[model samples]
Target: MGTTVETGPFGHLAEDLADLQLPTTDAEEWRYSRVADIDPTRFARAPVEPALESISTARATIDDLLGASTQPPSATVVVVDGSVSAAEAADPVRIDVHAVQTVQTEQASPNAFALLNERLCSAQVTVTVDAQARVVAPIVVASVVTTDGVVVAPRMRIELGANSEATLVEVHRSTGPSDSLVVPVTEVEVGRDATLRHVLIQDVSVRSDVVGSVTARVEASGTYDTWIAAIGGRYARTRVDCQLLGRGADARLVSLYAGGGDQMRDLRTFQDHLARDTTSELVFKGAVDGRAHAVYTGLIRIHPDARGANAEQSNRIMTLSDDAWAESVPNLEIENNDVRCAHASTVGPVDADQRFYLETRGVPTEVAERLIVAGFFDEVLDRCPVPGIAEAIRPTLAELMSGDRT
Candidate 1:
């Protein structure tokens, strides 16, 4: 591999640990999140782990990890202990999945976790779809960290050429003692008139913590949509940035997260429109029960030169216990005229009126609250980019709601 292990801006930033050090609540981004729970220095100062030959000594199939799906995947890739262990591509002619030594450099950003991933990541996954070729089967990528006290950083890139179409599903899971950490970065590029559907599901052990981010750039007439489902982890966080850089480009982001016990679910998103006639929409919802916590912040930015851009964003979170807490912030930054933009956000408990109505109709209070929580999530679940994700998570959500309201 000709790739420079740590020669880019990331390496430089990694050396300067000033702002990248463990953040405090004084920082705006770490306000709602439990900054005290994460000890960045512990993971950052550990010895750099070498690339793994295999992530796990014992491997499990996709179905065993994530239940059966209505749409069987056409291609599959597995990354364990931070290494790409197995890869299968149904049609190698059009879809190229391989490992390379070199990667193009990226612009500098304030995302500390992203820079950390670049600085330490030894495993990289790349996918390229040939121009004008449509892949009907979906692609599945599963990543796992099965060791204790090990920090895993994985990097990935997905490229779709003009007129090509495909779907990708990313699954992240972990087993073993919860004294582990994972930070993943995925960059996506959609070419002219191409279409890409992406979904991410994170279900690590509740004792583990994960911080990840994704960035996507869409070209002229391209359509890129994404959905995320986050359920388990001690402190799980994900950030997304989607840029519409060409005319007629369209992108949508829909996400869901649920937390129970002492877990934390943190998510942030940005939709940037850089061209005229481009459109973007985002919807995110979540629930926190027991002593759990959840946070969401989203922003839509329309550049001055981006005339006729349309943007919409919505975020809501529900708290099921008195000790459970949630925070939501949705904002819009517009520099263009004659453009459409809107944002809405809310954080609260189950509607009292709705609950009262259900109780009057002979429904138990606990059951009524469960139904309301289920309904709150269905709005976004039904609009997910993929078809089978909602069904696969239904049982999990139901169990979470019915098991322990406290």
Candidate 2:
């Protein structure tokens, strides 16, 4: 694929990448996270067919190793080897289901993989939720990046019509120990009075490296809720940027991430209020162990005309091991004094007092520690709008705390 420069409201990819390069140890965001260990030159582009059964079977081999339950079976579009499956699109919104490759890259801030995706991304699955329609089923989009020494760029575009409502669940999966690189980009447009709820789960294996970004536009009176969860990956970073374009728009952002055994995950979020009466809130929680590191950075901007805007952001981190590290930074750039904005963050280990209290109550130190960790994550889980998901995080957290490698 050849790269052609394009301009739009979001900005050009090449323009953004002019001075920006793929992250390295020198990069502020990559300081704690190192990527050189994964020899990028050894990666190959993934194949068309992923041998789903074979990989699924391999994953099952670990059933006895892990106590956490497997993801619930549901209607999903599994993208393997950089291509989406052609199976019928079930419970989709307004867009067609068939898998088609990329056309022209959209106008947006570009990065290292931007040019590659403009050319190599194999298929595009478009999904749109019509105006005023409320969709109940969660649209599940899963991707497996397994190519060795190759890079894959996947793009997903979602459009929500005026007054429409929908929920999207995107999952990232990896098979085996193959080295892989993936750059997935998502663009969302929320029409006037529309509400879009997005839940992104990055449950990749230990061998994959991922860099993803989501850009969203909310029109007048629209609402957007985004929840991101990342459990595993070699090197991972997720960027969420949203703009309230019309007056009276609202947004809610929540995220959870856990890193262990040399893995690293970084989250960068941006909330821009450009119109009057816009409101937004964000809450992010993270945990790190076994020399792993995590970072959470959030920015809330209120433009000059965004009077009466109310925005709040909070990030909290729990470090489980002495070798692990985590950081949180919440920033507010307010140009409108009439708006109400506040931001705060906290990063540290579990409360020893609480642990000692639990231990004094006859609980073993290990069990007590697990309980403390569980309680730390419960804050976010309890707020999960999905019924079963919140209840499911406990056991997962338990397995991780239990020191199981699975």
Off by over 4 Å in 1: 1-22, 40-61, 65-67, 92-108, 402-406
Instruction: Report the C-alpha lDDT of model 2 over 189-211, residue by residue, as the tens digit.
Output: 88999988887766666667877
Q: What does candidate 1's lDDT look like per residue over 1-406, in tens digits?
A: 1122222222222344455656677888777876577655454322233234334431463465444566667777777756566666745313333343334435325666776676566657777777897887778888777666656776778889898998888888765544677888888899999999988888777778888988889999999899888886788999888889999899999888998888889998889898999999888889998888898988799989789999999888999999999988887899998799988898999999999999999999998998999999998788765666788787767765554422
Model 1 lDDT vs. the true structure?
Answer: 0.76
The C-alpha TM-scores of every prediction are 0.87, 0.84
Candidate lDDT (C-alpha), each: 0.76, 0.69
**Poorest lDDT segment (10 consecutive residues) of candidate 1:** 1-10
Quote the lDDT for 78 in model 2. 53
